[model samples]
Target chain A: MAEVKKMATRDAYGQALAELGEEHENLVVFEADLAAATKTGVFRKKFPERHFECGIAEGNMMAVAAGASTMGLVPFASSFAMFAAGRAFEQVRNSIGYPHMNVKIGATHGGISVGEDGASHQCCEDFALMRSIPGMVVLCPSDAVEARAAVRAAYEYVGPVYLRFGRLAIPVFHDEGMSFEIGKGETLAEGDDVAIIATGLMVYEALQAAEQLKAGGINARVINMCTIKPLDTELVLKAARECGKIVTAEEHSIIGGLGEAVCAAVAESGIPCKVKRVGVNDEFGHSGPAVPLLKQFGLSAENIAEKAKVLVK
Target chain B: MTYEENMDLQRKAVKVRMGIIEGTHAAKAGHPGGSLSAADMLTYLYFKELNVDPKDPKNPDRDRFVLSKGHTAPGLYAALALRGFFSWEDLKTLRQIGSHLQGHPNMNLTPGVDMSTGSLGQGVSAAAGMALAAKHMGNECRVYTLLGDGEIEEGQVWEAFMLAANYKLDNFVAIIDKNGLQIDGPTAEVMDSGDIAAKLRAFGFEVEEINGHDFDAIEAAFNKAKETKGKPFGIVMHTVKGLGVSYMENSVDWHGKAPNDAEYETAMNELNAKLAKLEAM
Candidate 1:
C-alpha cells in the first residue's frame, strides 16, 4: 500500500484562505490572537494588509466580522472552537447569525482531537450550538482536500457559515480533484447490509470500519457527511431505505451533532431504520494524547465496526 | 452654531421625542426613557451630520450610523422616518407584528439603520468593524455609533474601544448618551462608569463632553471630532432621561414602560406646547 499523506485540516484551512485571498480581493481574515494556532497566520503572512488581529476577544471579533460582512467584505473570523462557538455563542448568534451576515467562522481544534487541552478546550458542542442558529451553515470536512474545498465553498456561499476543523494530523484520503459541495454527502464505498454515515475526523475512521466489516462478511456503505446543517436528508433517507441498519460516526457529542441530525432526517421521513451513533457519549474529555483519547472514548474504527457488526447480526 | 440653527435642531428634536412617545405608547411596552434622551443626538445626526440620502439609503459611500444603544430604536426610527426613510405614520406600528421598526435597530428591515443592535456592548464592535472596513477599502466614509452609559459596563464595549484605538480609526465616532439612569436606578448606583470621557481618552480617543440637548454644544463637539486625527472620537453627552416629557424626566420607572392614556396625553400636550414655542420662535 502507498504511504498515505497526513495533514491537519487547520493547515488546509489556512492555505485555502490564502489562495482565496488572491482570487477574492474582498476576502479578509480576522483572528482572536489565535492566528498561529488556528492557522490564519498563513493567510496573514501572504496578505498582511487584509489580516486583522482582534486580540483575544472572540465576541468582538465575531461582531467585527459581522460588520465587515455588511460592507461587502467576506470576513473569515478564526479562533479555537471553544472560544468561537462556545464562549462567543451569543455574539455569533446575535451579531452574525441573526442578521444573516456573510461571515465565515473558521473554528479550529474541534472535539477531543485538541490533545492535552483538557475538557475546557475541547469543543464537542460547536455543531450543536452553531446548528441551533437559524440560517447558519455548519460544515465539517473529512480530510485536507475536503477542508480546502469547504473553505472555498463557504466563500462562494452567501450568509453565515461555521466551519469546524480538527487539530490532529489525520490521513488525507480524498483526491484534490474531488468535487465538494455544501449540503451534499459523498459516498466513498458501496455496500448492501449496513451503512456508516460519518463527518469530520470520523469519516476516515468510517472508511476503515467499512474495510473491517468487509473482511467480516458484512458489506458496510461509507458516506462522508460534510454539511451538518441543512443536512442531506435525501442521501440520509436513501441510505435508510437501502440499508435499514445504519451507524453514524463523528468526533463530537452524539446528542446534537451529525448522528442526531441523521436520526432526525430518518425519523421525519418515517423510514423504519435502526441507527446506532458512534461518538463522544455526552461527556467532557480530559487531557490525553489525541489517538489514545479517541480510542478510549470509542471514537475509533473498531468501535464503529463493532456497532455495525451488532446491527448486521 | 447660530441661534436659528440651534432652534431648528431643537424643533426637530422635539418632533423626534414626540415620535418616541407615540411609538412607545402605541407598543404599550418599550424603552421610552432612553429613546427620549437620545432623541436630540439622533435628530442632529439624521438632519445635519450624516451624509446619507433618503432616496439612496444603500449607497456604499454614505456615512453609516449604528444605534449601538439599540433599545433606543424609537429615537433612531423617528429620526429616519422624519428624514424620509419611511413614513412617520409607520412609527405608530413600532414593535407591532409585521412592522419594520423592531424593538431594536435591525439594519436589514430599516432603511437608514446601518447595523442591527440590541444586545448591549456588541454594536460598538460592529461600528469599529465598519470603520476598519472603510479604512481598508479607502471609502472615505465615517462610521458613528451611540452607546448607553450602562451599556459600556458589558466589557465587550471596552474591547471594541481598544480595537478602534489600535486601528487608529479616526473616521469613527462613539457617542455615549450619559442619561445617568438605566432600568435599575441611577448609573452611579448600578455599576457606575466613572468618568467616561477620561476613560475614552485613556482608550486613545479624542474626548469631548457636552450637554446632549444643547445643539450648539453638540455641533461644536462633532466639529472637534472631525478635526481630531490619528485616533477615534468619543463624545460623552450628558443627557436627562425623558428630556422632553415632563413627568417621565429623571424617573427610572419610565425606563422601559409605556405611559397610560392620561400620562400620554400630558406628555403629548407638553411636547406640542414646546413645538408651538419653537414654531413661534
Candidate 2:
C-alpha cells in the first residue's frame, strides 16, 4: 500500500450519498440486505424514510430501485456484485436501463473479495455486464476519495449509472484537489514509454507498477479510468497514439473489461501499438484471502508491471 | 360522469376490443386474450378518469399510464389511437419494422407512452416510480398501470407491490387483467399466482374486485379508487379470456394466436355490429 489515508471505497459511497441526500432531497436508496456491506447503512441512519430494504431478492431490489428512480427519486441500490449484476442482469437492463431511469446501482463484493464466502459471491464480470447496456454509465473508482466523487457524479448525471465497489479496504489513490469527471480519466503518473490504463482497485496496482517501472528506467504512465461504459475514448486513443504501446488492467475478466475497451478503441482507430491486457485469466476464483486470490488470478502489482514491461518491449 | 354516461363508456370498451382486434388482425400476431380482458379497465381510465391531454402527450401535469404486460400492446395501442393521442391509422403499423408500434411499449419510440414496458413485472414498478414522482414533485396528478394475471407470477411485481405499501403511494393505481390464462395454458396450471387479491392485500394495498368487462363496475371501482383516503390501490379485475368474440371467448388458444382469414372475417363482422351500435349512440 502507498503512503495515503486508509478508507473503504464503500464508506466513501455512503458518505457521499448522505451529502447528496442533503443536497437533493429526491435521492432515495435501497439495499438487498447489504446496507452494511455497501455502507448505505450510514444513509439509513440519516434518512430512514428514504431508505428501503427489499430483503435478499436482488431482482426485486432492482425493480424497486427503478420504481423509486422513475418517480423522481434518484435511487442508489446496493448489493453484492454477483447478485446485482450477475443474477439480476435482466432486471437491471429491463427495469432500470430500458426506461433510462436516473437510478444509481452501487454493487459491492466485486472481484475475488468476500474471500471465504467463495466464488458464488465474488463478481468478476460486473463491469462487462453493466457496460453492455446502452445508456448505462459504468464506473469503478480507484479508492475511497474517487468512490465518493463517483457517487456524486452519478447522482448529478441524468441516466442509469453503475458503481462497482470492491470488498477490501484499499488505500487512497487520488488527492482531494484531484478533479473528477465521469468519462474522462486522470493520469496518475506521467510516462512516455508506455501507458498503463486501469480501473477499480487495480488502479493502485497500476500506480505501484508505474513506480517500479520508473525506478527500472522504464517510463510508464498510469491512468485511473473510473468510467467503463462511455470509456475515456479520447484518452484511450491518445494513449495508444502518443505512447505507442498500452497495457490495460482491472480486477475482472480479460475478455470484457478495461482491456477489451482499450483494445476496441485501438483496433477501431487503426493504431499500431503492442497492446497487452493484465487481468483475471480464464479460471474461476477460490475461497481464500483477497491478496492470494488476486495473486492466483495473476492480478497483482508485479504481474501488471511484468505485462507493462512486455508491452514496452 | 353519470350512470348513463358511464354506460356509454362501457360501450366504448367494446369499441376498444374492436380496435385491438383490428390492429392484431392487421399485424397477424399479438396477445389477444389479455388485451380483451384489459380493454374495459384501460378505456374507463383513459376516457374519463385519467387527467391526460391528447394534444400534449408530454404535459407534465398529466397523469401517467404504463401497460406493464406489453405482449398485450394491442389493447394499449388501441386506447392511445382511439383517445386521439395518436392517429388511429398508426394502429396498422403495430409490431411491424420501422413502425412506432413496437412489440413492447417503448416510451422513446412511441408517442404518449410514459414508460417503455415490455418485460413483464416491470411496468408496475415503473408505475410506482411515476406515482412517487408525482408525490416528490408535489403534483396532484396520479399514476396508473395494468398488468397480466400471468405476469404477477414474476417476483419483481411482488417486490413492487411491497414497495408501494412501504411508501404509501396512494396516488398510484394498478390493475391486473385476470383472464386466468397465459401462453402455456391457464395461469393456474402455469404455477398459480396464488389468490391474487390476498397476495396484494398482504402486500399492503387497498384491493378492489370488479368485473373488468362491466363498465358500470369498472366506473364504480375507479370512483372507489379516487375515494380512497390513503394507501396505494390494486384492482384485481376478473375478466374472461377473449371476452367479446364468440369462439374466441374463454379459449386459451386465442391468447397469442391470431385468427385466420375466415375467423378474422367473423370477428370483424361481430365487431362491426358492436361499432354500428356504438355509432348509433
Candidate 3:
C-alpha cells in the first residue's frame, strides 16, 4: 500500500488559473485581498498586468468581475466562500447570474473544513446560496486533479460559475486523465447494495466508506457529484433505481446541499428508494483542527459508512 | 459649444424628458424624478459625447455608458431610442411584462445599455471593470457611469471608487447626479453626502463640478475628463430633481412615482413648449 498524495483544492485552483492564463490571453483574475489565501497570488505573480486587487470589498469585486465579463474578458473573482457567496449573494445574483456573465467565482475555504477560523469563517451555506442563483453553475471539486480540471471546464463554459474549494488538504485520488464534465456526475465505484452519493471533500470520504462497506460484505456504489447546480438527474435517478437505497454526503448543510438536491430528483421522478442525508445537521461549526472538526461534524468516512449501513439494512 | 448646437441638445433633451413622462405615464410606475434630472446628460452622451453606432451596438471600440442609478432607465431608454438604438415607440412599453425596456436597465435586453444596473452601487464597479478591460486591451474606448447622490450612500460605490483610483483608470468618468431628493426625501435630509467634489478628489479622482442641465458645462466637463491623466475623473453635477417638469421639479413626491394622465399631459405640454422654443431659436 503506497501513501496517497494529498493537496488542497485551493492550491489546484491557483495553479490552474496561472496555467490557464498562458493559454487564454483574455483570462483575467480579480482578488479581494485574499490573493495569497485564495491562491490567486499564483496567477497574479505570473501575470501581474491581468490581475486586479479589489481590496476587501467582495460586493465590488463581484460587480467588477461582471463588468469585465461584458467586455469579452473572462474574469475569475477569488475570495473566501463566506465573503463571495454569503456576503455578496445579491451582487452575484443580479450582476453575474441575471446577466449570465462569463465570470468564474473561485471561492476557497469552503465548509467546516476552514479550521481554527470558527463558524463565521466557515461557509456551510455557500452551496445553498450559489445554487439558488438562476443561471449560476455551482461546482465543488473533490480533489486537486478534479479541482484543476473543473477550473478548465468552467473557463470553457460560457456563463457564470461558482467553484468552491476547501482549505484542508485531502486525498488526491483521481488520475490526471479522469474526465471532468460540467453537469455530469462520475461513478467512482460499482455496486448493488446501496448508493453513496457525495460531493466536494465528502467524495473521498464516501470512497473510503465504500471500501469499508465492501469489507463488511456490503457492495456500496460511490458517485462523485462535483456539479451541484444542473444536478445530473440522469445519474441520480440511475443510482436511485439501481441501488433502491441511498446515502448522500457533503460538507454542507443537509437543507439545500447535495442531500436535498438528490431528494428532489428522486422524489420528482417517483423513484421508490430510501434516501438518508449525511452532513452538518443545520448547526454552525466551531474552531478546531480541520480533520478533527470534519470528524466531529460527522463528515468522515466512519460516519458515512455508518449512515450507508443504515440505508443498506 | 455653439448656440445652435446647445439648442439642438436642448431640443433633444426636451424630447428625452417627454419620453420619460410618456414611458412613466404608460407604465404607471418608475423613478421619473431621477430620470428627468439625468435627461440632459443622457441626451448629451448619446447625441454628442459617446462614439457609439446604433447599427453596430456591440462594436469593441465604442465608448460605454452605464446608468449606475439604473432606476432612471427612462432617461437611458429615451436616449438610446433617440440615438436610433431602438424605436422610441417601445418607450410606451417600459416596465411592461414582456417589454425589453425593463424597470431597471437590462443590458442583455436593451441594445445600447452597456450594463444591467438597478441595484444601487453595483453599476459603477461594472463601469470600472470596463475601463480596466479597455486599458488592458490597449483600446481607446472610454467608460462612463451615472450615479445618483442617494445611490452613492451604498458602501460598494466607494469601494469601486477606490479600485478605479488605485488602477488609475483615466479613461473612466463617474458622473454623480446631485439631484437633491431621493425616494425618502431630500438627500441632505436623509443622508448628507457632504461635499461630493471633495470626497471624489480625496478618492484620487480628477474632480469637476458642473451644472448637469447646462450643455456647455456638460461638454466642458467631458472634454476635461478626456484631457485628464493618471487618475479616474469624477463629475459632481449640481442637478434639480425633476428638472423639466414644473410640478415635479425639486418635489420629493416624484422620486419614484409615475405621473397620472393629467400630470403627464401637463409635463408633455411643458416639454413640447420647450422643444418649440428651442426649435424657434
Best by DockQ: 1
TM-score of B chain for each model?
0.99, 0.95, 0.99
Query: How big is the positional error of residue B155 in model 3, measured in Å on the Cα after superposition?
Result: 0.4
TM per model?
0.99, 0.94, 0.99
Write model 3 residue lDDT over B1-281, tens digit each, in one string.
88888888988999999999989999999989999999999999999999999999999999999999999999899999989999999999999999999999998899999999999999999999999989988989999999999999999999999999999999999999998888888888899999999999999999999999899999999999999999999999999999989999999999899999899889888988888887887
Ranking by DockQ: 1, 3, 2
- Cα lDDT tens digits for candidate 3, A1-313: 9999999999999999999999999999999999999999999999999998989999999999999888899999999999999999999999999999999999999999999999999999999999998989999999999999999999999999999999999999999968889999999999989999999999999999999999999999999999998999999999999999999999999889989999999999998999999999999999999999999999999998998888777
User: What value does the lDDT take at residue A143 in candidate 3?
Assistant: 99
DockQ of each: 0.89, 0.53, 0.88
- Badly placed stretches (over 4 Å) of model 3 are none
* Candidate 1 residue-wise lDDT, A1-313, digit = tens: 9998999999999999999999999999999998899999999999999999999999999999899888899999999999999999999999999999999999999999998989999999999999999999999999999999999999999999999999999999999878989999999999979999999999999999999999989999999999999899999999999999899999999988999998888988898999999999999999999999999999999999999999989
Tell how far residue A3 is off in model 2, in angstroms. 3.9
Tens-digit lDDT string for candidate 2 (B153-261): 8878887888778778888898998989888998899888878988888889899888887777877787887888568899999999888888888898998977777
Selected candidate, larger lDDT, 1 vs 3: 3
Ranking by lDDT: 3, 1, 2
The alpha-carbon root-mean-square deviation between model 1 and the true structure, to one decimal in Å, is 0.8
- Per-candidate local distance difference test: 0.94, 0.84, 0.94
Clashing pairs in 1: none
